[model samples]
Target chain A: MTAILLISSALFCAGVYGLLSQRHAVGVLIAIELMINAANLLLVGFGWRTGGAFGQSFALFTMAIAVAEVVVGLALILLMYRSRGDVQVDQATELAQ
Target chain B: MNPLISAALVALGLPAALALLLAVVPKLRRTGKPAALLSILGSLLALSAAGWLAATWLHDPKQVLDLTTSWLPQSGKSMSQVGVHLDGISVSMLLVVAIVASCVQLFSLGYLSDEPAPALGRYYAYQSLFLFSMNLLVLAPDLMQLFLGWELVGATSYLLIGFWFTRPAAGKAALKAFVVTKFADSGLILALITLVAWTGSFSWNATLPAGGAEWLALFLFIAVMGKSAQFPLHIWLPDAMQGPTPVSALLHAATMVAAGVYLIVRADPIFAAAPHVRLFMTDLGAITALFAALIAMVQTDIKKVLAYSTCSQLGYMISGLGAGSLMGGYFHLTTHAFFKALLFLAAGAVIHAVHSNELSDMGGLWRKLKFTTVAFVIGSLSLAGLPGLSGFYSKDLILEAVHESGNPLALGLLMATAGLTAFYMTRTVVKAFFGKPSHAAEHAHGPGPSMTIPLLILLVPAIGLGWLAGPMSKLYGRSYAFHLDTIGMVTIALGLGGIALGWLIYGMGLLQALPRAFAPIARIANGSTVDDLWALSYSKLGMGLARAIAWFDRYIIDGLMNFLGWLFMWSGQRVRTLQTGNVQDYLYAVFGAAALIALWGGWR
Candidate 1:
């Protein structure tokens, strides 16, 4: 259980760093999915160790939310690629000072 | 309905209705003849009503025909009445006002007939309005209603004076007259306020205590001085001759100037309650009488001479009232109205034919304009107060009143002023009627019967109204008398001596060289310096104050507002950079804020 928690924390830290510093749209979406999967791994590990049906049901709910997130992220990336011929976040700064 | 009320309705309502019709109806306004006829008929109806009221008053001396109805019936706190009081004094004033008004309207048929239709219509409209206001003033029972009539007359005077608005001089003169009188009107307004506050009433019958009454009397006297053209306010009258001749006859000579005397007589109890105010009025009247007569002696314009004489004669009436003889003052007002109106209308005819107002341009017109010359001579003789004329009876009475008051200084000044009146009028007549044919007067001709008939009618009063003095005095509650005493003889001698002197100088050319001797005195009497002083104080000083106020508003008041606006713009520009609409930057800001909040929550 301790090892699983360490792995999930590291994934969440990487996701946050990517959200703030990544210049590519696809990289940002992959990082977001990584954070969601890390949360799902933590929930499933806790459920198996505690031996409760409630924790397992909550882990299932997290998996469903992750699925919806990936679906919306891929659609946005496809639109960006079609409009600009490249899915880069830096090129979308039309409101720059 | 009372007959008195019916008289008042005719006197007040007829002219107002006619004025409204002439103003609103395009058909009436398109023709001069119909307007003149309407004005004449309205005045004639009013005159008959006044005649009927006078007859009724004669039958019963104690009969006070008063009609009052609430003016502001909806007022929960106070109610004022708008009505008429038909007493002996009011009846007499009504009679004089109507007679003069009708005569002037009749004469306007010839005087203004040559003008275009619209201008003639406008003149008759204003004339009707003036008649209504004057009659209302005479008949008003309360001070408030009297003030309404007062202000209306002043407005009508302005409109009539500036009737020929194409002339810049006429417009300026109108404005000057209005401003000067309005300044005095402020004093009247203040007096009304004080009186109302002290007694809670605006009726002339409200008896005030001694101290309050004195202040009110002083304020009222100041207004009277302005309206009557006394002393410093006398400057506007000579310039007011820029109006048509009929207007001069109606407003300046016959009725409007007399209003001041009428007011003081109406408010005699207030003035009597303060002896000092009466004495002050006497001194002011005497000084104005002397100075205005002096000015009249030197004027070159024909109308200016008559205008100054009007002022001087009004001074005599005021002095009579001031010296404690209301009977004598109002008596002179009645007689003066006839002769002065006659003089002005006759002069209008001469000026119309000669096409000039200059005495120098009016020589040798007597033969060509025979009827007008005869009428003018009757007016001039009466004005000089010759024995047996109407002016003789009234002027003699005023002098006797001053003498009886025991104020030797006022008496002497008034007597000398009377002599000066004779001198100046005789000089004017001699220069404008009896000399060799002037270039301007060479083609002068007689006016039509529309003008000559009014002069003929006024001649009866000018020559014979003095006999009515005894009966009129009795009506005013004074004893009737027709005897001539020492003062009367001296005044007559002085008057005759003045006419003889003027005859020697101008009529006989005995004093053709006298102008050289009188040059130094003439310079002061011409009054250019007095005119300059008044213009400087009233106009230039007012302009200077206005400019200073404008400067302060522009700099100090505007500067603070401008600085606040600049500061707002500067701070707004600095805050605008934070509104960068990039989605990535907003998301980064939100995530950074969330991280900081989580760290703070853990520490707590």
Candidate 2:
């Protein structure tokens, strides 16, 4: 369980760093996906330790949501690139100060 | 409702309704004939109602009618009321107003005939409003209602005096009259506030605090001096002649100027309590009388001559009242109303005929306007206090009152004023009617029946109203008899002598340069020095204080407001820096705030 947690924490930290530093819209989506996978890993580990399928079921639901979110996120990035010839998220800030 | 109340209501309401109709209805206002007809009809109805009220009073002169309802009620305290108070004074004033107002409206039809339809309609509307305001003042039961009516009449006077607002002189005259009277009205307002604060009532009969009566009387007389056009404040009346002649007739003769005397008579109890103020009123009246008559003697404009005469004649009435003779003052007011209105209307006809107000433009007018000449001569004779005319009777009574008051100086000044009144009037008549025809006078035309009929109607009162003095005296609950006493005989002599002296100077042309001897006096009388003095004080004192107040308002007061605005703007500028338009920065700050909140909650 401790090894599973350590790997999950490392993945979540990498996702946070990528989300803050990335300028491209696709890079941000990839970083978000990494964070969700890290949470799923922790959930599965906890379920196995408790000797039940409750946590594993939750992880399955989470994976399905993540798949739907990634599809929507990629579509938005494609529309932005078509409109502006670029998908750099920072340059797409129309509502910024 | 009582029948008398119903009559009073009609007398007051008809004109108010007509004024409203003529003012608000675009169609009626645009059409001259309908608006004039409506105004005349309203005035006649009010006249009949006033006649009815007078008849009721004559039937029982001793019976007083006071009907009031609570207007501003306060529990266990005195409240203001709205209603009528009909006594000898109010009823008499009502009849005079009704008669004069009706005559003036009728006269206006011809006097203002040359005006455009809309202008004529507007004129009649103002006339109706004036009638309503004067009647309201006559019928007021308390000082509060009286003040309301007083202010209304003053406003109407302003409107009427500036009726020809296209004329710059008329506009300025109206402003001058309004400001002078309003300045005096502050005294009245102060008296009213003090009266109410101390006595808790606005009734004339309210018991005043110690020494309050003198102050109130002094204040009231100050207002009278302004409204009645006494001495220094009288500068407006002559200038107010820039209005249409009929408006000048109504203002000078019966309504606006007479309201002051009526106020004095109505508030008799207060004046009676303040003997010192009464004496002051007598001396002031005497001075105004002689002063205005002196000025009248030198005026080149016919209307200005009559305007100054009005101020002089008003002085006589005021002097009479100040001498504690109600019958003398009020009776003179009644008689003066008829003859002065007659004289003004006659002058209006002459002006209408020659198309000029200057005396130089009018000579041998009698040959052209025969009936008007006759009317003018009679009015002039009455104004000069010829024997057996209405003016003689009233003027004698005032002189007698002054004589009885033991003010030898006032009596002497009044006597001199009577002679001057005769002299100036004779000079006017001789210059305007008897000399060779000027170019305008040669081509002059006579007034139509609309103008002549009012003159003919007023002629009766101007000639014979004096015979009713005994009955009028009875109305005041006093006994009076018409007799040519020593004072009466002396006044008649002075009047005739003045006429003779005027004939010698202007009529016979024996002493043409005699007037030149008095030119210095005339120059002083005609000078604008008094007016300039008032203006100077206003600029130096009133404007200076206003400037200080304005500076304080702009700097000190506005500085605090601007400081508050700056504080809010500075704080807003600091807070706006948080919005950098970067999603990453906003997210970081939000997450940091959430973590801090979570840690604090965990510690708690």
Candidate 3:
């Protein structure tokens, strides 16, 4: 279970790198979702490892948080499209300070 | 809350409440006079608190009245401590702000009363805010409070500077003061953060850790330059006079401009830790004093001359600090406060009497406004360091402190600057009131009862504060009588020389013949180039650097945004083309994405 958690953390970091490197809008979005799922996968792995129902309940909360995240995330994409008619996050790099 | 805490909080609240009540109630906002009266009263109360602080100082120099309670205590971290420190420094500044703000408020009551604009309410409101922020600044227990006071002071300046919002010059002046000071404030904030991080507290105790003291000292001094109209950053002060006359007194003459020096004085123990920084402070003080006095020589505006006088006076105080006479520095500061505020208020009266700032536009107006002439003459005498006036004792203390500075050049420059201060001030006085009537003198009228009373009241301090210098020294337990023989003689010579030269040039019209000999150099010196160069440097950092940041933000930063916006317009049309009623293509792309992900994951 610890092995799974470690692998998922690596996967999330890789996902972030991929998201940053990607030029295409869909690829970046896919990479971000991958990062979130990687966290969820680790939570489930911890649930199996701990075996007290505590980690499992926490994983359930993470899943709920992940759902809200996706909803807001998709809404942002729609809003960006409405305003700028483009979903390329790299092109919308106004926060690059 | 303890007594000091309650008083501190109330002092901060009074002007703020006045600001709000006058604005919303409308009826209370009647003329500048009523608003000014309320503000003056509030400041008087605050100053009375300062006097009480001084009375406490007579017993114990470090007699702090701390009041604190639990605030945002984490599991391990302790509760936040909050209380005003009525130390020597805080008491000095508190009293200065109170006295100067009260006088300016009274002057404004009569000065701006006749202006038909509705902006008088807002001006009075901002003046109250200025007092509120200044009070917080000196009494602030921690860095956070100091920062709040700092920003509020700047904001009040922005509002007050642009009081005549319709005028482009006023708008520019306000913006220049805010943006320029913020630039210096950024450096100061960084230094403060660095100091706090290293020391874990912002109290003015003598326990700051090692290696960071020098950095903190330098940064703090830099902040002083920006705020106090010190060298290379003081250019915004004169332009700031474009606001109403009372605003001129509030900002340029009295409390707001001196906040920087007040900060330096408050942080004395911390700055003392860095010997080299203290030396650097000495040179900064010298350069600013000499340079400001030089520029003041060529000024034609009554307000601008006083503006430069503020710069020169602040230079003396800052130099006194560097000279290692804390008591002397503060003595000069207090005396300078009374006279400078009186001068600005008197200038305001004159501007009201004859609606112009140009000295050339004013002449023989002393006869028209009898009380103003008296007030202005006393104020000017103090400024030129006349004996028996407030300035003589304090300024002599500064020069003697400089003499004890063990630096001859510094002493020389200070004396030369003294002569220049006298010369230029007499020019301003002579040009405005002493000479034959200029056309503007026809409109000159004495200010009403409200104004004359404040001016007269200020005169009591203007002449009296000089005698208090020795007592003030005793008040803080570090008594030292200055060997002021040279300084005293020099003061008289400067005063007499200034009066003589003013009489010779304008009164005798002697310069009319020498125009061909002196015209080019005089024009160049006073013209925007030298002033701008002085201004650019005095503006705190090179305006070029600010222009660079603005240029990058304006052209590069905004340019990128615009580029993206343009790209969106063009590419958006193309993106719409991709969606040309083709559901099959969209499905194909999604399936392709899923297939790619599946293949990638399967390989991993």
Query: lDDT per model, in order?
Result: 0.87, 0.89, 0.76
Among the numbered candidates, top TM-score falls to 1
TM-scores for chain B, in order? 0.94, 0.92, 0.85
* Residue B269 accuracy (lDDT) in model 3: 79
Rank candidates by lDDT, best first: 2, 1, 3
Q: Report the candidate with higher TM-score, 1 versus 3.
A: 1
Point out where model 1 deviates above 4 Å: A1-18, A21-93, B403-409, B480-490, B511-572, B584-604
- Candidate 2: regions farther than 4 A off: A1-97, B76-78, B555-604
The complex in candidate 1 yields a DockQ of 0.36
Local accuracy of candidate 3 as per-residue lDDT tens digits, A1-97 = 6689789978986776666567556666777778887987887787787678876787788778877877787887788788988876545744322
lDDT of 3 by residue, B267-382 (tens): 77778787788777777787778777777877788888888778888888888888887876788888888888888888888888788888888988878987798889889888
- DockQ: the better of candidates 1 and 3: 1
| Clashing pairs counted in every model | 0, 1, 8
In the order shown, the candidates' DockQ scores are 0.36, 0.28, 0.01
- Ordered by DockQ, highest first, the candidates read 1, 2, 3
Please give, for residues A1-97, the per-residue lDDT of candidate 1 as tens digits. Answer: 8999999888887887887678888788887888887888888888888887877799889888888988888898898799878877867765754
- Give per-residue lDDT, candidate 1, residue B101: 92
